[model samples]
Target: MTNYDFVIELFIRVDDAMKNMPKHSQAKLYPSELVTLGLLYAIKGVGERAFFRWADRDLRPLFPGLPERTRFFRLLATHQDWTERFLAEPTVLGIIDSYGIELLHPVREREKTLVREREKTLVREREKTLAPRIATKGKSNYRWIMGAKYGFLLNQLGLIVDWASSWIGTRPRKAITIPSSNP
Candidate 1:
């Protein structure tokens, strides 16, 4: 009900889940403590400075061994991988969708199309190296998009199971399989 109660409960859950994670004796905060703080920061949806101030003022009682502001944040960042323990496993059913984002107009793409139409070989190796290759021509319902597209796979409970992104018209391997709960 209260923030303190919620934080304590969250810490308990995180600690129970992370029982296998080895903790360093020299570490100021336990792995669970750091994870609890990180989870709080994510759930609060506030800037680091504000979260630090709030924790220092309100949460100090809960986490008496709280480190200084910088070290506290650095610890969370360093051990971020620990949070993966909370990721929901892929279920038997899921939803998949994609969204296309436009970064630049298809000027270069159109130019290349026109050149190829004339049966002319392109010799713009230098231009190719200088272009932004991260985004490619992808299509959307509105029109052709000259950018990138991202796809999300969500389980029945709406938790993200997997995701992929690629150029338009190109498909990524669906390697994320939903195994039955038995195995």
Candidate 2:
């Protein structure tokens, strides 16, 4: 079917979904029309002005009550509660993904000890800063610099629900206790 036809179908579906809902008395557009436009905005996946233009140009015949550009968006914002009933249930499934960021490269970054040695005068004072979290296992010839690992949790719709960063967790330190000679 053509694009206009699809819009009409979408409106009908929204209308059917919200059949029990009542429209506000002073509202210019019907409840169904407003909800359809809102859904269209999301489905069209365009900026506000562009989406409005698409509707005003192509779907004006279907929605003659379409208001001014900014007003239409305002109405959509205010009347968003109407679409809640029609929205699908949030998916139970979610996805988690993580990535590593190399904040300090060995070539460009200096070790804490090296920095202290370079400035001998500063050696008497304790180092105030920490080294970058080190990364140990890469096949590349370049020495791996310290980095952080970041993770995101996304819902079924690919919306980010939460995220976290390992600010100092990637440091490579293993346990190795040495026996005292006196003992």
Candidate 3:
């Protein structure tokens, strides 16, 4: 189907879903308009700035009420749940999978030279700011690495049913103890 056709279909579906839901407080853009832009964002898979630029140039005619970049993003975030419900398909069986997303190279974590200095500096800065909440040392494939793990649940049709990511849990250190000769 053409892009305009897809946008129209998506807008209609989301608009129908929104009919049963409460209206947004003081929203200038309709839910249909927001969902259309959201579908465009997902299909384009481009960065926010690029998406905004393209939309302004090409999509303004179709979505004349499209807001500024930041405002558009805010609207998306505010209605994220509605968007998810609108996009998700019905499924009976789902396959779950997970993978580690390494933030730093395992070898680089041990390196103490200028070659690794920049990465180290960045990690240090991130730790100071986002620490255990976002990044942590965790095991992946029996190897310790600094990173986060992402999990996904997919339906038989290979569509994602759900997804999440979080800081990896740190492994517990083995305690050292001396043998007691008296015992």
Please report the candidate that would top TM-score against the real structure: 3
CA lDDT of each candidate? 0.80, 0.70, 0.72
Query: Considering summed lDDT, which 10 consecutive residues are worst modelled in model 3?
Result: 171-180
Candidate 3: tens digits of C-alpha lDDT, residues 42-141: 8899999999998899878878878889999998988876665643453666677778888887677556346446688776776687644545667877
Angstrom error of the Cα, residue 157, model 2: value is: 11
The alpha-carbon lDDT assigned to residue 146 of candidate 3 equals: 75
In model 1, residue pairs whose N, Cα or C atoms come closer than 3 Å (at least 3 residues apart or on different chains), thus clashing, are 138-168
- What would you estimate as the lDDT of candidate 1? 0.80
TM-score of candidate 1 versus the correct structure, residues matched by position: 0.61
RMSD of each: 8.2, 16.1, 11.2
| TM-score of each prediction | 0.61, 0.50, 0.65
- For model 1, how does the per-residue alpha-carbon lDDT over 127-178 read when each residue is reduced to its tens digit? 4774546466767867887777778778899998766667766675444445
lDDT of 2 by residue, 1-183 (tens): 999889889988888888887877887788899988898899999999899888899989999989999999889888866764743333467676766666666564456558868887775543433223244333222435456656666668986555565543443233222223362
Model 3, residue 13: C-alpha shift (Å): 2.9
Clashing pairs in 2: 133-146
What is the TM-score (0 to 1) of candidate 3? 0.65
lDDT at 17, model 1: 93
Whole-model lDDT for model 3 versus the true structure? 0.72
